[model samples]
Target: MAEPTAPPAAPSLQELQHWTGVLGRAQQMMMEAGIDMMAQLPAAKAAPAFPAMFDPAQAMRAGAAFWTDTLELWQRFLDPAHAVRAEESPEHARDRRFRAPQWREDPVFDFLRQSYFLIADHMVKGVDSLEGVEPRQKEQIRFATQGFIDAMSPTNFPATNPEVIEKIVETRGENLLKGLQNMLADIAKGQMTQSDTSAFELGRNLAMTPGKVVRRTPLYELIHYAPATKQVFETPLVIFPPWINRFYILDLTAEKSFIRWAVEQGLSVFVVSWRSADASMKDVVWDDYVERGQIDAIDTVRELLGVEGVHAIGYCVAGTTLAATLALLTARGEADKLKTATFFTTQVDFAEAGELSLFVGDEQLKMIDSLSSDGYLDGRYMATTFNLLRGRDLIWNYVTNNYLLGADYAPFDLLHWNADVTNLPAKWHQSYLTDLYRDNKLVMPGAMQIAGTPIDLSTVKTPSYIQAGREDHIAPAHSVWKITDHFTGPLRFVLAGSGHIAGVVNPPSANKYQYWTNEAKVSSLAEFVAGATETKGSWWPDWLQWIEAADATRVAARGARIPGKGKLQALADAPGEYVKTR
Candidate 1:
């Protein structure tokens, strides 16, 4: 012992007794949050699966592995020479809550973030690894577990989040008071605010493209967008947007407006403005929308243009109805009336429908029916269902911004439209859920009926252009691909770069996300993707080209400025009375 042994080195700050204790407390809070959310999973669906949901032996093994991993991490963490760092990979770095400088630069927070992920990631893998559970039921469990984990992120809690702590310190606890007030305001609004709601109006900064409402119906109003070119395609184009949402989404602003861009392309463009559902619409059925709301709009466009054939485009749910209408028309031997059909992020087959399917089972449908006080689902209910699909971006992110950080939402036109939810008529919704979602009837020959006409998708042979968003969750690209199977005619499938709205509403001026195409003969979406070529601009031009090819005859462009040409008359300005109401 000639050289006195140096005193044992003290633990690194990351592994100090006090820091470990702090982490233990933080872990407790996260676990409590997870427990609270787990308690909310629907008992009706989950109770049956509970026995098969998790193997207790496997779960214990997972728990033990998690602890083992944690111990190993602590060993590396305690080494004085080793520094803790958050994963730098794109996938791991996406948790925006940890983007703050301190989260990575400070070892304490770095350890906390890593620890939470270690636990949550194990839980996710464990749920995924569970065997013997029915495939569909297994999917529900996985989804619920992920949502619960996301809700319990360390960034969501005030004390666990250093950014929020700094805000409190900077504002001398006034941030808490402001946050409380903000929470109260959000509660009053009945939904979280994702944009500056007061910053945009229906016709001013948003949905500002010039147009006029023509031929109003009880269910919808047809709009003739003011013409942008002198000569236009002879075939008029009518857009049947999803009635579950307002029509202005396609008409938002001059730049992002798909409606405006179509007019500018020297095409006769008309849109259907659907009336928001009320108690009066309780008895409205699927056939009513197909007839009065969609088919009627198509008839109005043809009549106004004095054309035997019209081009029709449908978005989301409207596209499903369009498909049924195509079949119904075919049953009546009037299939040629619609010369061309275009579908935007629409699904006819529910076999591979995304997270929305979780809400379509009998128990949930019963709940929805019960909530329909006078026979209509509230707008907020649908909004909440969609919001839950992307809880991190849609729910907790806003929670941190509006509640913890006390910040006002940035003004965004798209989000403003998103906040404007649409109510759904009960009968229309019921038939939709039962026929399409529950029974998968639309694609089956003679299985679906619209009005008195039996619908058979294969009987409809109109040329079709199907555009599906690569990132769409509601209508997954795969689910949308099923349309190609049933169209039974010349069909072009295009995959765009972004999610549903961004992918569809994309304009070339912005020069943003890319689209994919495949000219090679391919039966399945997988083959299409394998042979697909990438294009670095909006799909709008691609669609215009398809429209031109579908019908090349040119006619004088007609706009709302003209009083009436055939059987249509201008009723009011665009972004009409229906859209302005809730």
Candidate 2:
């Protein structure tokens, strides 16, 4: 069978135009150099058309060496005594392409695997050594090259992959028919593959935490989780989860739940479950997210808990909104509404926003706005965009399993939560892309406004705790650290182990990841990392302790507080209507 071809990644028209101009100039420079070279060497037959960085002679020599290596590889394979051993590399850690016992003994498969890695390394090095290319162009070339490399991975093709071959033999070709059926089903659904949809149920298996929706608005639902402890903190804890996915990420399972954990710690836990957007919410803007989303949720929580101030925690996009809201409230001299603020992998400064930044800029932003002008931005588009960033895991892995190997996707809570995407309001998403990613207005004092008040981050002096994942590509740790400079009050920064979501979802029981915390404020991120202390396990307990210490003065044990007792009554059961909209 033919190997699966890599998804095309042709350069955009803009990139092509820019590079065409560069190449035209380069050709002009080469022609000029050729004339000069011919003038210097009267006896020469022809002039060279090469740039200073690229020497034809050197390229020829490199090509000769590559073939020499290829010849030696073949020679070793033909030798009777030749045997191959498993080679491990950081890039190919989880790759099980050539792991079968036969690969070690089979000369053909061994040589192919070896040659593949060698060629990939050479290509990467050549790209890295291109001195004359623009930084952005270099990044694009590398990204495209990496995609090709992933596509060429032996496991992606059933014939070359030993595991798939073994499976075919064991099942007597039954797996191929099953794989075909899976591919057909995926095509029918307009999905790349089956994402193991049966793995999770919204209210039954997942998002099962006991809670009641005390307040509901067009924008979001405020969920007050039933407390596990008798006495709760006088200061209520309201969590604002990212609207891109469901709020259940915070309450995924009983063991991994940060929400349930807080409840057990004697804190009145209130979570904001954002409504999945549709055509009706096409007019919802960033202002609506601020007023009707965060502010409304906060007000409802305060009213129910009867607290003057609430401890607020925001994750990802929600964190960005919360920070902006706090800035707006501060401008209006109402900063005292929040007791302590915690931000999880939130990027206020978009300067170093990582790979996602590639999809921004004027042209892309205009395209996005134009496409979603009439209605909400489809969740599938956003999901595909995110998946493209980590295609090896999110895209091609499923292609290999569901299409090539005929394997059922494993049940994973994280994957299920990730697949449950939420739509973005047209105006809201456009404003976000324009103000935050495009213009980077959040870091600029008085640059953003909400509710007729200019948002100045410097005026927001609420005590803060910021946590960022070291490997978080979406919101890089460096970008999160920049928030410290904009904040007027004391700030603590923690660098957690793992990627964007896993780092935040880490529970103490997992005991898998480690975190770094620096007590002393540092001028630069490097300085902070240098002085940071590494602690094994989740950063949740440390954050909880920080909030508890800040809110030391507590009231008598009040037992589990009932939702809607104070003001807004319970509208429905926990995980509310908005969460189950999809």
Which candidate leads in lDDT?
1
- Shift in Å, residue 564, candidate 2: 2.8
Distance (Å) between predicted and true CA of 480, model 2?
Answer: 1.7
Q: Which runs of model 2 end up more than 4 angstroms from their true locations?
A: 1-72, 79-89, 93-105, 193-195, 361-363, 366-373, 556-560
Model 1 lDDT tens row, 1-582:
498755444556555878878776766676556545544566424665554544678767866887777776666556636745334557668867788977765656767788888768776786677666677776777788888888878889998799999999999988888888988998998988899888998788888877788788788877787778888888888899998888988988788998888888888788888999999999999999888877788777776667898999989999988988888888888887899999999999988888988888878889888988787888998999899999999999988988999887799989888889989998888778887888888888878677766788887789999999999988999999999887788998999999989999999999999999999888899999998999998988999999998889886654433434445666788877888877
Rate residue 176 of model 2 by lDDT: 83
For residues 31-149, write the lDDT of model 2, one tens digit per residue.
Answer: 34433432343112122322422557755665576556555654454442463434557665445555565555454455556656666665566556655555544565566566666
RMSD of 2: 10.3
lDDT of each: 0.83, 0.77
TM-score of each: 0.94, 0.86
Q: What is candidate 1's CA lDDT for residue 412?
A: 90
- Among these predictions, the greatest TM-score belongs to 1
